[model samples]
Target: MFDIDRWREIFQSINKNRLRSILSGFTVAFAILLFTLLFGIVSGLSNSFKSAFADDAQNAMFVRVWQTSKPYKGLQTGRTIQLKNDDFNYVKDEYESKIQYQSARIYKNFTLKYKNEANSYSVRAVHPDHQFLEKTMIDEGRYLNEKDLQEKSKVIVIGRLIKADLFGEKPALGKRINVNGSSYLVIGIFSDEGGDNEERLAYIPVTTAQMIYGNNDYISQINLGYNPDLNLDEAISFGKQLERDLRFKLNIHPDDQSALSVRNMAEANKNVGSFMAILYAIVILVGSGTLIAGIIGISNIMIFVIKERTKEFGIRKALGAQPLSIVWMVVQESVFITTIAGYLGLSLGTYLLSLIGDSLEEDYFIKDPSVSTGIVVGATVVLILSGLIAGYIPAKRAANIKPIEALRAD
Candidate 1:
């Protein structure tokens, strides 16, 4: 209902007590502002963590070996540990059920030249399944196939940035690029969300690298994606078991991490999951506390305002004003102040978050911090309801007072 008279009265009351209204509104606004910033920052941090691991498949694991740090059986410290085709085959055959995708990696640094444009890029020779393990997206042409490995084909998959650098606007697929001194066909152009470093590298068949580069079965690392059906705990357990078996088979000390180690994405995921859970819980608590404080502050202010207006309320009652009208007026005024103040706080918080976009990513790992619309609306609704309650309780009591007694409230 359009009640102009009622609205006019509310405006008059607010105008008369500007300082009191501002104080009440300030409390609510400050609380909401704090709540918004806390949640937004935490959300950004969560995003950063997720993107940090985005380079590899969530189920991926890497087996890397280096020079031994501890003596084992008859072997002395500093013994060089090398992963070979045999070690890769052992994992593939033994843990076939536990593994989804498997690839052996051999690292190389080679200068790739297409016509006159040339640049040195990191090259990784890997099995076909390496594409999935690294989450590499084929933008054009196809990744390495089994035939390439068997035939030791001189073919390579270049990254998006590599193509840009070497081929410019020209198409790179099916073109021949000089690698080191040998000419290799470009089978694919790929992109990676892992960022520019990944996009500057290239991949070739593991056999091709072994045959041309070293003529040996030596591999740099073993990469595998655990079966996606397994839960984090199960995947982590499988990784640990595999690490132990590989260590025993290689005759390395069981505790020698440098000699044999498996970097499991599952363990990292679990730790991150736990950390986010705790972080969200803490934010909920602190946000809730701030809101409660706001509600309490408004409640106290409303009580005082009602006290100050008791004599006026009695005079109006004496002049035939209904008790419900008095209660409604106070409730309406409370809701208006809280609603406007809350909106201002929400807007300020959102604007601050937008300004902070990616600025904290490098140092603090907070990215794109902001609250969802539903949550902001929900919080606003809560504040409105709290204001209604704060006004109703005291106004109702004051409305029910006998006119003479209310007039004598002083």
Candidate 2:
């Protein structure tokens, strides 16, 4: 299959129109470069979204109570609805099999002190299961245990950033810190989540929080995780039923429109999916435009080359060269130039993507932009196809020319 004569003729033809060949190659190279960059950016956006959402509890739902915005069921408007321990227990009992984890939270903003070092911080009182609901991982020591909750132990788990700020690389285990003038033992440090403000907070058992903060009768929010096998509609239906039961048991009107709010992770995922879909569409459109332009440029340049070599092609045909050979000669030239230039462009784009991918730090978008192996192979295939297609028409035109007429034309 090694045809030295054919390769030599192809090289001679390209050398005869070196500048035009290079220009044609540049067009294909630029197209591939644009396509690669756009694909990488889209991939980065997808990766960033995944990273941002990975820490969140899967299939989770949140519930909150607020002042009634509308009067219903004989209750006057403006009545405030609040959740209590009874309501949390009722929901758990009703949906025990369907629920994976559940927790109630009481938040307080207070000043924490250790000797002379003091800082204003937020504290959360949560159940042991709250760790699962929040997908929090312990970096050091241990998280609150059931015994801590049952006995109302004055133990606390600080976020990594909080630990760094308050203790500064020093081991913080067994250390005592004052929270709102109440002494609590630091038992554990949470893993860092990369610039999350939540990393600056501290967590304590629900009972200890109620004892010290005296908010046992009130909870600011409730978080629940459900089995992923259930559809969103089924989970939401179950969640709404629980919400109604809680409202009724707590003396809140069932028809109170704004007294209770329920949110599911499914809706959040749908929104994210829509955003990614639109972004991918835009990237494909831009990349396709560049590719088409390059293909057209290649077609025009091949046509020009055919016109310039009309006499030579006629002479070869007159000497018994086959029409397929003539077509292969032109196509080989196109493929060689485009492949070499396109590869260079692809390499450059890949290098740039790798260099900048890790440096991106935007919130929930554009992280780790890099080309995958499949994408590289697909782009190469497109370039090869473009080369053959661009040369086809010009090759046909050259093959149809009569030797006598081509020789006679000035």
Instruction: Name the top lDDT candidate.
Output: 1
Candidate 1 wrongly placed segments (more than 4 Å): 311-328, 362-365, 399-410
Question: lDDT per residue, candidate 1, 178-292, as tens digits?
Answer: 9999999999999999999999999999999999998999999999999999999999999999999999999999989888789999999999999988988988888677766
TM-score of candidate 1 versus the correct structure, residues matched by position: 0.90
User: How do the residues 154-215 of candidate 2 rate in per-residue lDDT, one tens digit apiece?
Assistant: 99999888887788878888999988888999999997453567788889988887776764
Model 2, residue 57: C-alpha shift (Å): 3.0
Residue 360's C-alpha lDDT in candidate 1?
71
Q: Which ten contiguous residues of candidate 1 have the minimum total lDDT?
A: 290-299
Q: Poorest 10 consecutive residues of model 2 by lDDT?
A: 356-365
Q: Candidate 1 local accuracy as lDDT?
A: 0.90
Candidate whose TM-score is highest: 1
lDDT (CA) per prediction: 0.90, 0.82
